[model samples]
Target: MKILYKKGIAAVCRIAALYFMAFLIGACPVAAEEEQKTPGIHTWADLQEAINESGPGELITLTGNLTALSSDSGLMIPAGKHLTLDLNGYVLDRNLDSWGEFGSVIQVNAGAVLTVRDSSVSGGTITGGYHNNGGGILNRGTLILESGRITGNTVLHTGGGISNDGTAILLGGSITGNEALLNGGGVCNKPKGHMTICADVVSGNQAPEYDDVFNQGTLTLQEAEPEEFHFEDMTVVRSYMEELAILPFLVMLAILLYVVWIDSYLSRERKRIMLWIVLLVLSLILQNYTEYRMSMQVG
Candidate 1:
């Protein structure tokens, strides 16, 4: 009975150790195999289909120009998903129709995130909107635009280029040649909305009031500075140390010490002591190698 109890306790400890190690070192779960596949959008139908198939954090790329064939709202991003639409130098045009009850080119719903990059939105005409806004794009969720163009869009009331009722980040883009009947010819930041422009151009827009941009909410304009790195700076060394994640290493060391204690208490076998020594050496080697790689990346 005594021998059996000792064996059971040893087994439990071994299982616990293995579980803890796995919890610390295991990789994050990957997306589904189907979701891993990136599909290209060419036509309006293809773009809609791709959006439907996308999951959160998925990327969809546009390969060619897409013209809206119907008078419906063009390309809605589903709620609760963070989707990135890479235009890849493509154009999305509304075909000069007075369409879209809401947004003409793209509509981002509440609790969703949409990132548009390297594209152009043109010829969008939004009439009779819910709030008479967003001719080119309507964003109720988070919207990010990078290296794109918004031009030749018209709205009946406000926000000829974009109507942001949520958060919008414009990074290195151009908003030009858009017209709004009332306010915000280039972009409208609503009362509850926030717009941040970092190194973007807002020019050649027309509106009855606030021709370039209308901000009823929080609007931040920041100039981007070119980053310069100097190898001789001691701050680089401090940053590298922070990136090394020393807390995790300390926790690992504590766990290893506990493992050693357990082994010492259970058995005094030369084989088990040798095994623990080998594991300790391996752990140190791995930790040092990881730290070296991180330092190299920082440098």
Candidate 2:
């Protein structure tokens, strides 16, 4: 057990720490430019300069724990041909619409792939907080979130955790406490994008669990099916037909009794009363619907 720990985990942390130092020394300048990248710039302008000068496929490593409290972010990885913002357990900038101001912690374009490892992305809410569509990661191309945590990110739409406009393969990690205005409170796959949720835990998310498929790709759910079935537990959240027999009818009955008793004395407003009655009756008819549901009283 000890041997595996050192080889798999301990070694990775050590390498990250070592490389982080090297990253701050301007050792990796993308080779395409004369400008050298530093570890701790302590300002948003310097961080922006590093991003502007960064080249495709360049590795910007954090040597030390650089905090971007001011306007400047710890690192600004914008949309380019291809690049990777290697975070060695360092914190990114914390603010509003940071992606718009400084761009995402790292943005990927179409057909591009952004890979993140052993890191934490906080400061964003479920609705456009830390990330946009591809919330924690706004990807028009592709994204690989491996062995990390994307929490405190919020989106007004799908993928409160991650909105994948393209293909997204979830190799490892946990995506919780994210909110989506629409589907996939945890993750949203739009367009031709695909998401592989394997060997991970997706719980404690807000918003409706809609089709993880935002893109027309196949929505593959690779989890164990529960024995006790429920309407909400399934794909559907509401049952109109069930409400007709139970809740809707009961509610309609109460409304009719109230209107007839109170408005009976006001004969001059007969037309108005009739209008309300017709509207309520129409609502009852339209509200009725049926679906294959299991009894909640089952053992």
- Candidate that would win on lDDT: 1
Residue-by-residue lDDT tens digits, candidate 2, 268-294: 565365556545544443333111122
lDDT of 1 at 171: 69
Q: What is candidate 1's CA lDDT for residue 251?
A: 66
Please give, for residues 48-112, the per-residue lDDT of candidate 1 as tens digits: 88887877565566666777665545678878877776665667776654534544677888898
RMSD of each: 9.4, 29.6
**TM-score of the candidate numbered 1?**
0.59
- Tell me how far the alpha carbon of residue 218 in candidate 1 is from the true structure, in angstroms, after superposition: 0.9
Q: Pick by TM-score: which candidate is best?
A: 1
| lDDT scores in order | 0.67, 0.49
By summed lDDT, the worst window of 10 consecutive residues in model 1 runs over: 225-234
